[model samples]
Target chain A: MRTNLMMTAAAGAILATGMTTAAMADGHATDLTLCWAAWDPANSLIELSKDFEEQSGHTMNFEFVPWTSFADRMLNELNSGGQLCDLMIGDSQWIGGGAENGHYVKLNDFFDANGITMDDFLPATVTGYAEWPKNTPNYYALPAYADVVGWTYRKDWFERPELQVEFMDTYGRALDVPANLAELKDIAEFFQGRDIDGTTVYGAAIYTERGSEGITMGVTNVLYNYGFEYENPDQPYDIDGFVNSAGAVEGLQFYKDLYDVGTPPGSSNWYMGENIDAYRSGQVAMQMNFAFIWPGVEADENVGGGNSGYFPNPAGPAGQFAQLGGQGISVVAYSEKQDAALEYIQWFAQPEVQQRWWDLGGASALRAVVEDPDFATSQPYAQTFLDSMAIVKDFWAEPAYADLLIPMQERMHNFVIAGDGTAQEALDGLVRDWIEVFEDEGKI
Target chain B: MTYSPIDRAAAKTPDGVARRIRGLSDRTIAWIFVAPTIFLLLAVNIFPLIWTIRLSFTNFRVNRPNNAVEWVGLRNYERILTDPDVWNTMQATAHFLIWTITLQVLIGFTLAYLINKKFRGNDLWTTIIVFPMMLSPAVVGNFWTFLYQPQIGLFNYVVAFFTGVDPASFSMIGDVHLAPWAIVIADTWMWTPFVMLICLAGLRSIPDSIYEAAECDRASKWRQFWTITIPMALPFLMLAVLFRGIENFKMFDLVVQLTGGGPGNTTTLTSIDLKREAFEKWRTGYSSAYAVILFVTVFGLASIYVKALNKVKER
Candidate 1:
């Protein structure tokens, strides 16, 4: 009787262990939620995650929101203790605030434990958006995608012999893609009234959105090019001389000139989507946008597919600079599935997986993958983005940076649309605003 | 006196019961009935307002909620008053409000008068006219933006036919000089019907006898309109002005879509500027102060308006 009882107990223990193992094999998480901005690339990320689930035996859920409401929605979710998302592709600007508020996991320890070095990613890609401060080791996120501003123009229009001859004769120079602000202005003026294929096209469409980050992103390229620094080099928060420099004013006037002479009427409200539409419909000659639109522009029947060409922003007197705009993959601090989330990041970072991401028309932050000849050869615009990445710069990423940016956006819109004040007046206003914010925060 | 004791005792019994019921004062009973509403008001309206007022005194940021909030006293208020940007936005808001209100009242009242005539297809015309207001502001803004497009927009095509300016060369929203007007035009299109509907109700309420009396007096059509129609419609017109004034004062969404308060800042109104300060900038304290200023201004205006409305009613 004792022997029989022992055998039955052993059999029950064995069955229990088998069930636990089966559960473990299924996944640590029953389901996972991922959030990102609404776009074609976001769709591509979702598609890529399907392979992750297939490999790991987990399910993936996604919440994609439009760019306009992206920050507000995420802020609401964080404040309300909404657990709808386990992993989020957050804007780089949110890192400081997110970290301070305990909204995101401090991934430094995780990276250290996993043997991941920051060197694996592009310097600017890691430092610009993902790092809280320049060259800081404390990482709240891993670089998912890197998007920098670049110019897109119609090669067909530029190649027209008659137009080229006319532009050369009028400007006393050959119109081989503008290399500086003066040439850019000249090119815009030349194309302002020109009819192409019986449809009138404007010279350029730069973002000037008021409600969101559109204007800030568009104007920063010019501001930085024209030597507008947010703070004094040594003092950081001191903005007396740098806020409204002569170069900055020149840049602002140039923008005004372009708007006056080149842009189509009623174009003040053009954001990324509108700009893309305008460019795709052959209504505009050039557009300043991110590499995220490469695939769409390439595949699009109207604007892409052998019609669009990409170049870095023209040089300013201060040198060339483009605003780095992209998101980072972050693990939510409140998420229950830390191990699984880490595993997913590890899986995504694999060389083969990164290659697949590039192949699928997604910009990879991985240096090796992005610079791979095989990857570049497959995609037509890969080299254009790769070349443009060298000159990328990013906006302020402080916790109070959003607050600083708000006034800048307001002032920019005011300067550009209202003509209420000069660029100097606007920048000085921004400096004052920033000083007040910093003083209020006791940061200074 | 001894004979009256029995009568007095009998009177006292009924009088005591009456006094006991009356002792539960009407004001006390009224307070009891309204306690729930008062509590709700405190919870929803009063509490938030008090919080906002308190926040306006401190430097609070939404992004860094846990950061130490400092007492800045009236600095926010002082900054706003001194800031030229704030003043410019106010001027823009005023510009938009004046134009939209003027155009809406004139157009709305005219349409209401015509529709109140019981003309053929009056019901259909009223329905069609009010349709713009029925659509969402975002939707209206989007479609209007499309219409304002210089290249393919139908608006520019019509303008081009007359003005001969290359449609591609002028942007109604992009031009700094014209952006405010663009917002005003879009807002007028969307909200004029609301004013018209209110005015139509007022017009319909006027008795036919007034017109008949005016006709017997041999009053001309123009004279009859000036006397009977104008006096009778004043209340509704004021009401429309009050509503539009309050709404346009806080207008954000349509402008956000239409011009986003750009080509630079030509269309940035007080509300858009406030949003930039509050949510976008995360300067909760500064924005709260802005909100309070707006509230005080609107509140004072509304109070005066309500008094004027009462006086009109008395007339």
Candidate 2:
């Protein structure tokens, strides 16, 4: 009874101490909310924020939503001028919309005042995720995470002696990581319906999700390699020849061929999550997915470690480039706690913290962090990541980016999956749609 | 108006709060009690509808609120009316609506008829049949994506097991020709039970004396079913059809989760397209116009349908 009384007393003291600490935090600390997609990196950010909270006497509230609904939820928050999110790790595509509409606070002054130079980050990321008018140095947000669409293949399956011999005999080449779009197509076909260890596997699992930006994101990787520009640099919105170029049509057709003949059954309408699931389940021989998926793939028991091979997107006829996939960190303009938000950004930019962030599974956009000599050997797929980031391009970041995106998504999906028309016809329709949207926006 | 005796007595009562409460007439008290509901209706429903209609007249993009909201009267409506893609979505919505309703009505009424008869384990079977409707449509759509997986999904495996065909030979959601039907099948599966329940209610409500009189007239069971049972259940079945019709007309989540309006624009229903324009594209004015068009279509059709339904009831 005496011991029980002592224990009760200790518990009461602990509870009192907790309440006192919380009350102190509530009084002294500024509560700031940071919003981003609920991906693996968000957990790393959560773990990394403890130091920020402890040092700055500020509480970090996080609003991590699923990738599917992240844009809708966050954009609605920004559009309505809600103060719920003080900071947002917005999609790279949103830079134009976020910047132009005053949804995001201009970060040029913050970077200047805080000694955060744009040159410290990778050029591709700054251009893709931060800049609004394409090549302009007008800073809006700091490139928070740098990523690119790359391929992960079954290295074990490719290295099998009998399989290699069969592939060599059939295609007159040894099976290896594809160096071009044609070779990738061939490899995908070779593994399309083949059995490995008595388990039936499909070719590659590529993105074909129609409702949003999935198919467009996936197809742009190939389209960029085939020299498909959004529009002519000299003549904007004069996209008839540029968007529906012979090479672009061929590239689109190639993608459709791969999807129509190579991918697994019921693989239509797949996006990031489905691609990861397919790879992890050993249902597909290859997966064309964003670098965000690499960590999870690398850790999966069936497909991770030395079992998989990583490579940047293969070159097409014109050139090679991977579609950029990343986000920028910006302070919301309406945020009452903008000062605290800037402070968090400044803390996040420190080299040591970036290094620790990388350690905690974040793909930092800092050149200093990513270009370290040891960074290449830090993880198995790190070298491929570095190479892929070397040749990265982004989609239209126009403030009216969605208006530009949705029609293309529809046209591409209609042609590629639905077989509604020829690739040329689809691109023709897309150009018409894009021209109308641009006219509506009074951009052209 | 003269006060009632009760109100006069309460107004003279000693308690102040009680006197105040009792001083109100029935109509005033009713208004006071329902004021919150009225406010909420105005806030959530009436105001948005008005705002949506107002926005439908302008060239305003939701994402670009700072930009000038141009007065382009009827332009937005004119564009939406002429847009081929919008019409395609309408056709898809209509196709989904007709097929799902037909299948649901047929299957639902059949199930209801079977269950209306005495059975050893009728309650258990009814509960099992109704289980799918209780699930969240999003969750059901997601799991159906798995179940429709050609390689590893149970749906194809079951089909293969019964048909002696490879599971990978055909893709339900991936095939353009099959995707619309896939959505139809899923909607039918989830909502047939709702129709069945309505039908069951209809069957149970049919006065047994009529059947007894039919028996007295030496009418066969089949003849009585054709003449008496169906005629009695017709109103309930029609009610179920109207509810399902409206719901399926705005079908977004399940079909979206299942096919994402894909295998191309084959399944791109109007709601998904409107959502894409409004939220995804942030073409607020254009989408508002689209919304107004859809509202008019559904409202007009429903009004006509209700009038017909009332006529049936009167008959």
**Candidate 2 lDDT, tens digit per residue, A226-339?**
879888889876777888899899899999999977898887888898899888888888999999878877788888878998999999998999999999899999999887
Report how far residue A150 has shifted in candidate 2, in Å: 0.8
The lDDT values for all models are 0.81, 0.88
| lDDT of model 2, residue A88 | 94
Alpha-carbon runs more than 4 Å astray in model 2? A1-28, B1-39
Q: Write candidate 2's Cα lDDT for B156-181 as tens digits.
A: 89999999999889889988888888
For candidate 2, give the docking quality class from DockQ: medium
Which stretches in model 1 have alpha-carbon errors above 4 Å? A1-27, A79-81, A171-174, A230-235, A417-421, B1-36, B162-165
Worst 10 residues of 1 chain A by lDDT: A11-20
DockQ of each: 0.51, 0.70
